[model samples]
Target: MRFFLSVSCFILTFAAAAAAPVIEPPLPMEKAFRMEARRDGPDIALRWQLEDGYYLYREYLSATGDDGKPVEMSTPPGVIKDDPGFGSTEVYYGTATATLVAPTAGMLKVTYQGCQDGGLCYPPTTVDIDPATLAQAMDPAADGPVSPARPQSQAAFPLVSKAAAEPVDGPGIRISDQSANGVVGSLLDRGGVLFLIAGFLGLGVLLAFTPCVFPMYPILAATLSREGESLSAGRGFALSLTYVLSLAAAFSLFGVVAAWWGQSFQVALQSTTATLVVAAIFMALALSSFGLFELQLPSFLRNRVAPARGSGGSLASSAALGFSSALVIGPCVTAPLAGALLYIAQTGDVVLGATALFALGVGKGIPLILMGTFGSGPLPRAGQWMERVRQVFGFLFLATAVWLADGLLPAGTGLLLWSVLAITFAVFIGAFDQMRPEAGGAARLAKSAGLLAGLYGVLLAIGAFSGATDPLKPLAPIAAARSDTTTAKKIIKDSFQSAASAAELSSLLKADANGAPSLVYFTADWCVTCRVIERSVLSDATVANALEGVRLISVDLSKITEANRSLMKELQVIGPPTMLFLDAGNNEVQASRLVGDITTQAVAASAASLKESL
Candidate 1:
C-alpha cells in the first residue's frame, strides 16, 4: 500500500510539471516595429509604430535617398532613458516619426532599431521606399489605425548591429569633428585616468579669468569682510574651503543631471522668480555691509546651533551661499565643462566625470582661497579703514545686484542704474570736492580716480537719455554717422533675425531661398560671455564681411520657456555663446561649431570653412 501511494504521488508531480506552459519567443524585428512611409505635404514622412512593451532608439533612426546621400530628417524630442546596455540615451515609445525633405523624387532607405521592455533587443531593420508609391501607401487625411507593414525578406535587407553603426573610436560624436569641447573630450580619452584630475584642475584655473568665474571674487570678498577682526588666515582658509567644497558639490550634481537627463539645470534656475530672489539677497547683503540692519539667526536657533568644525552659523551661511550662487549666477558652458558633460552623457561614467569636475572647481577656487586668506592683513583689524573697506564691499555688492537685475529691466534701464552707481561712487570718493595743497599721494590718487568716475558717469547719463542699450558702446549710435565701421556693425547686428520659438527658427531656415549658408547663434540677455562675443566677434567688420551672405538667426533664450528649451534640444546647444554653422541646405556643419566666448578670427575662419564646405 505504501509503494502504491508513493508511485501515485510521483506520477501526479510528473503530470503537473509536464502541464506547465512554455514561454514563447519574441516576435521578429520587423513585426515588433512596423514602418509606414507616406507623403505628408511637401515632406516624406516615415512613421514607426512600436509594439506594446517595446521602444525605439532615436540615435539609431536614419534615412538616405537612392543617390546614397544622407537626407535631412527632423525628429521630435524623445524620452530620455538610461538603458543598462546603451547608457544614457533618448528613446521613443508608442509612435516615432522621421520627417525627411523630398530627395529628388527617388527611392529612400530607412534604418531603425528597438528593444523589448525587459527582453532582447532587435537587430537593426532597414525598409526600402519608392517615393512615387508613398502617396498611395497611406491616406493623408484619415486618422484610422495603420495597417501591418509587409515584412521584407531578411536576405534582401541586411541587419546592422549597434556596434557596427557607431564609430569605433567613440559612441556618438565623431573624432574628426573636434570643436573646442570635442578637443577637451579627446584629451580625456587619451589622458591617463590618474592624470585627468590634474589636467581638469589646470583647465579650471585657466577658466577662472573668464566672465563666468569673475563674479565670484566680489561675492567672496563681501562674505569674508563679515568676519571683521576675527578673520585670521586659518579661519579664512577654513571658510573659503567650506564654500569651495559646497560649490564643487553643486557643480558635480548639476553636471551629472545635465549629462543623465540632457536638460539644463542652470537654465531652470534662471526664471524671473529665481532672478528676483537672487537680486533681493544681494541687495540685503549690500545694505548690511553699509551698516544697515544686521542679519542674524533667531536667539533660540543660534544657541542650539552645532559648534562642530565648519558648522557655525557663518560657515553654514557660506556653504549655502556657495551652493545657491553656483545655481543662479554662472551658466556659462565652457569647453572643459561641456566636454565633461559630454563624457558623462556618452559613457555614463558619473564617477570619473564628477571627479574631474570637482578638480576643476578646486582649481577655480585657488585664487579665491588665497584672497580670502589675506582678506584681513597687515593693517589693524579694528581701525576706521576696516569700516571704509566694508563700505567698498557694500558698493561691490550693490553693483552685483544691478548686474543681476539688468536682464529683467527695460531698454537703457541698466545703463541708468550703472550711471547712478558711478555717480554715487564718485560722490563717495569726494570727486567734486576742492583739494588742499598738503593732501597725501593716496588722497590725490583717490581724487583722480573719482574725477574719472564722475566724467564716465556723466557720459553714461547722456547715453542712457539718448536711448543707448550697451554700456560698453554707450555712444555707438552718435558715432555711427562718423564711423563707417560703426555703421557696418549696426547693419550686421540688425541683419540677425530673432527667433523666439522652434517654429519661427524653422520658418527662418526655410525662408532662405537663396540657399546661403547660415549661422545660428544661441544667446541669452543674462549671458555675460555672449555679450562679450557679440561686441568683440560678431560686430567686427572683418567677421561681418566674411559672413556677408550667410543667414544669421539668433534664438533668444532669456525667458527660460519650453520653446527655448526645445530649440536648445533640437540644436544640441548646451548654453549661450554657442554658434552652429549650417550649410546651404540648412544642415548643421558640426565641425565648424563654436561654444563659449570666441575671437573675431575664429568666426571668420569658421565662416570661410563653412562656405568652402559648400
Candidate 2:
C-alpha cells in the first residue's frame, strides 16, 4: 500500500510540473544605452540597443526651454540614416549609434519611450553616461591614458508610481516604430513571393466578372461565332490564344509603366483626373451597349479581317487587339490592377511586374478562351431572350457609369448626377417602349437621350477635374484638419517636462510635480501603423478631447543621429510611435506599448484608463 501511494504522489507531482505555464523575465526595457567620449577626436558616440519589435523616434528632441519649461519638439532637423543591406526584422532588434562633436563633454543625456507587443508600455526613461569610459572600452589598441571613472550619482533614477502617472488618451495604448527593414525583407522572401503570386492570380480571376470585362463577353462571343464553318478548330483555337496573348502583352506593358513611375503615379491615377477619365470611358461603353453608337471596325479595316492563309498574322492581330484592350481596361479594373501595381512598385523590376501582370491576364482570359473553343453552342440562341439579356447588360453598363461618376463628384453632387442619369435612362426606355416599329420617332427620341447623357457625363467630368464639385465627399468634416488653435494650445501646455535620457527618466521618477499626467508619443512618418492610427483614431474628436487634460508630445524618429541610436537602445524602443506616460513631475508611469485597432470606443477606453491611472 505504501509503494502504490508513493507512485501516485510522484505521478501527480510530475503532471503538475508539466502543466505549469512558463514565465519569462520582463523584456529588457526594449532599449539600452552607451555613451563614449574620445579625448583625441573630441567625438562623443551615443549608441542605443533596441530590442526586437520596437523603434526609437529619432527626429524630435525632448528639450527644456530657457525658462526651464518643457518645450515640445514638434519639428527637428536631420534625417535618420539606416543601413540598407541590413534585414528589416534584424534591424528592428539591432542597435543604432550616433556620433556628435562635443565642445567639452560632462555627461550626455538621452531620453526615449518604447512599446511592447503585449500592449503594455514602459514610461519614458533617460540615461546620462560618461563618454570617456565608452571611448576607452571601445578602443582595442589603447595601452595608456585611461580616463578616471566619475562618481555615480547618489540620487537614483526617479520612478513615478503607477498610481501617480496620468492616464493615456485612448482606451488602449500603442508603441510606434519606423524601421522598415524587417517588413521589407519579409515581403521579399520566397514565401512572400509565392503568397503575392497567389494573390495576383485570385484577383485576376475576380476582375473577369467586373463591369470592366463583363461587357466584352457578348462582343467576343459574337466575333468567335462569325468565324464560321470554314475555319478549322485548330485555327479557331489559335485565334483565341492569340487574343489572350495580346491581352497579356498589354497588361505587361502597363505593369512596366506603373513600376517605373512608382507610388506617385499610382496616387495620381486614383486622384480626380483619373477618376473622371474612367467615368468618361464607362459612359461611352454604356452608350455603345445601348446600341446608340456601334463600336465597329472601320471599313478599311475589313482587309485585315479577311481569312488568313496562315494563322500567324491573324493570331498576332488578335493578340495585339487583346493587348490594347488590356490597357484601355486597366483604369477600370482598379482593385486588381492596384494590387499588381503595388507589387510592381515594391519590386522596381520590370520583369517581375510583367510576369505578375501576365499571370493575371492569363487567369482572366482562360474562361473566354475555353468558351470560344466550344463556340456559341454553349450560349442561348439569339431571340426574345437575347434581347432581354442585351437590355440587362445595357442596364449594367449604365450602373457602372453612374458608379464611376460617383467617384468623381462630391456626395451631394454625385447623387444628383446619378439621379439625373437614371431619370434620363427611364425616359428613353419608356419612349422606345411606346413607339411603333414603323415609326422612327422612338429611335430619334432614344438618340436625343443618348446625346443628353453624353453631355451630362462631359459636364460631370469637367466638374470633377476642376474640383468645382465632388460627388463622393463624405457629409461629415474630417476631424484631423480641424484647426482650433485654442484646443491645440491647451493640449500642448498640459504635458510639460524636461527632456532626459533613459537614465534620466529613471532619476526623474523620484521627483514629484503637480499637474495632470502627460503622455509622450514618439513616432515617424515612415511607420505604416503610425499612419493608420493618425488617419483613423488620432483624428477622432473624442480621442483628441481625452488628450485635453493630459500632455501629448510627438517625437519624430526620422532625424535621430547615430549618437541618439545608442540612447534609443537604452530605452528599448524597437520601432516608432512608442507611447510613454508620465506623472505631473515628469516621472514615468503607465505606457501602452502597442498600437491597437483604430476605433472610437477603443480609443476612448484607452483614454479613460490612462486618465484613471493618473
Model 1 Cα lDDT, one tens digit per residue, 1-614:
44336537744753553344421224445556777666555666667767788899999998888888888888879999998779999999987867778776777788888887655566566777767655423332345322333222222212222112222221111212454235335554555444566788888888777766776787777667666567788778767766776787787777777667765544645567777887888788778867887665555555554243221236667777788667643466776776676556544456667767777777887788887777646523656776777677778878878877887898899999999998888888878899999999999999998888888888888889888878877886677656765245422446789988677777777775777778888788777677777767777788888888888988877666777776665455667777888887666665678877678888888899888879
lDDT of each: 0.69, 0.46
Candidate 2 structure quality by residue, lDDT tens digits, 1-614: 44336537744753553344421212335222221223324444344455554444453224332344443332222234343322232122244434444434354454554434322234456554444454322333344432233211111111221111232321222222311112222333434444444555666676677555664565455344334444455555566666775776677676667545532222323445555665565566556556687444554554555344322234435554576556334544243454345444433334444656766776777777776666645443445544444454666656655654554444346546654664565555553255556867756676566666655555554444444333333222332246554443222222434333333333334333555565656554333335445655676677778767765655455445443344343343333444555555554444333331235565566567667766
Model 1 stretches with alpha carbons more than 4 Å out:
1-157, 160-176, 179-184, 258-262, 296-313, 342-353, 374-380, 432-437, 481-491, 498-514, 559-564, 585-591, 612-614
Candidate whose TM-score is highest: 1
lDDT of 1 at 158: 22
TM-score of each: 0.68, 0.39
Task: State each model's C-alpha RMSD to the native.
Answer: 15.2, 18.3
